[model samples]
Target: MLVTEKSPIVIVGCADDNYSMPLATTMSSVIANVSSQRQVVICIIADKITQANKNKILKSLKKPNVIIEWLIPDYAKLTNAIISRHITIASYYRILIPELLPEKYQKAIYLDSDVIVKANIEKLWDTEIADNYVLAVRDMDIDATYVSSSKGLQNYQQLGIAPDCKYFNGGVLVINVEKWRRDNLSQEIINYISNNQQYIRWHDQDAMNAVIAGKWSELDPRWNSQAVIHSYSSWKETSLTEEMYNNVINDSYIVHFSSSAKPWKLGCKHPNRMLFFQYIDLTAWAGWRITFIRKLWLKVKDMMKKKGISFSQA
Candidate 1:
């Protein structure tokens, strides 16, 4: 398909050394799926990525119409933000994109490193933001209310937000850079994270939902089919109807591995996990797969750590 847009479509992502492979895989999928007629500029907020990995990433996305620009992030500003075993300070870097990029870029699509693009991203870029700060899909697994999972905003009542406000997954965001800058949304989100650290479960995602609760536009769930949609029972738990669930699972534009069980890791049962590897074959990390021995070793180490037996002691 020929894209008629005059300006380049700006796509933003964040990653550190640990997430370099997934980041490259995500961008490769974008390049593979995007229109050849449109110019694509990918701005990655890199945090301590090794030069070797940078070269691999560049090589993976080496296309005539695609340009890769790396921006070094200031980690010191994220010192007080909460992080978990799988989550890192890099997850919060999406909040910095508006100020980090040049003023000429008024809009951008922010994708998580764990996602694999299946459709032309120009379609997503064409989505109208209008007066909204962002356009995102509703979170399939969680909501605004604090429930048994402890994943949603715990202080919604305290924050004067309604109990039933829609909560969006931050995995795929079509951001309005101008709206964010005018409202100083990034700083407000950072301040919310700092002040309400105890209430943060999903960290930056939670902060963003809290700060921009009613201002964001909702996209179709097919745009961001989260990991939860893979399970029939899990899909029933969310707001999606049976048809909607099936549609998203069967034909997702972007498959997001939102759970801890990632496609690269052992025991990831998501049906689309192999699809991620399919995109991987199109990148610099082609033919890469985690070996069985390595998986077993990792499993054993996890079991040993749980049993309080350190590797040194063993």
Candidate 2:
């Protein structure tokens, strides 16, 4: 039976000139994987969007058990507001986590657009934050002190965060809505950015790390496991065995391709990118036909590049 209470997952992603359809397909795949009893509220923010674009977005989001909210940042002057506050790109995601969430749910999981869901998300929703804290996935890439070094220890010192608190990646977070409301963390965060705009490097991620460091519970890496260039290379060399890859696809609650190589791009070599196409069940044969042709082109280009390489001559 599908768990209904505490089962809704909230996510936020932006639309740009380059990619929206693929992102929509990714979101649809996410909705399909979750239990039918669960609800997904997605906030899509865009600037100077057109009617055609809006129609395209709506078509992609017309999924079962999904609620789509269109947020025009320019309509509310949020774009200007954000820049005036000197918010960084990383901070954008953090800022929206609270604002875009449904008021009814006390908790919600935030996911970046560059991800696909492979397992049911009820497992993540069921995790308890007994310490009255939120949960975040650890950044497997950077050093633990990178965020702390960017901002002085004294800044976080005021937020009740330890000087040596574990730095987390905000890409996937299980936020405590009640704590956020009680502490007024959302406004406080925006206020801090407005005040100390010059001191930030990574925008909201930096601010979030500065504030929510020790306060957050670390989630299992399996939940995120974003495929980056180095990890992809290492896997190709040896580390990512077939069994491991299959386990990641079958068992992972979410698969985030959070790097430069988006699946829609020309040379997306990540193993998980392949899995992304697997779950994207195109309702029409024409759509499937286009995707297959694209895949074939990618394979041919890859072969040509390999054949043309001069490793021995070099």
Worst 10 residues of 1 by lDDT: 142-151
Q: TM-score for all predictions?
A: 0.91, 0.70
Give the best candidate by TM-score. 1
Name the regions of candidate 2 deviating beyond 4 angstroms.
1-7, 17-19, 72-93, 100-102, 131-133, 142-163, 229-251, 279-314
Instruction: Give each model's whole-structure lDDT.
Output: 0.84, 0.60
lDDT of 2 by residue, 1-314 (tens): 23346555665666543335555666676667777777778777654445665676677677678888865442231232343222223226445555555566566666666778776776777877655457886665533333444433335655566556766666677778767876888777666667666555555666677666667887776777766423543334422455654554456667787765666656667776766666545311114323667777656755665676211100
Candidate 1, residues 188-223, lDDT tens digits: the string is 998998899888878898899999988888998888
In candidate 1, stretches whose alpha carbon ends up further than 4 angstroms from where it belongs are 1-4, 142-150, 234-236, 296-314
Q: Against the correct fold, how does model 2 do in TM-score?
A: 0.70
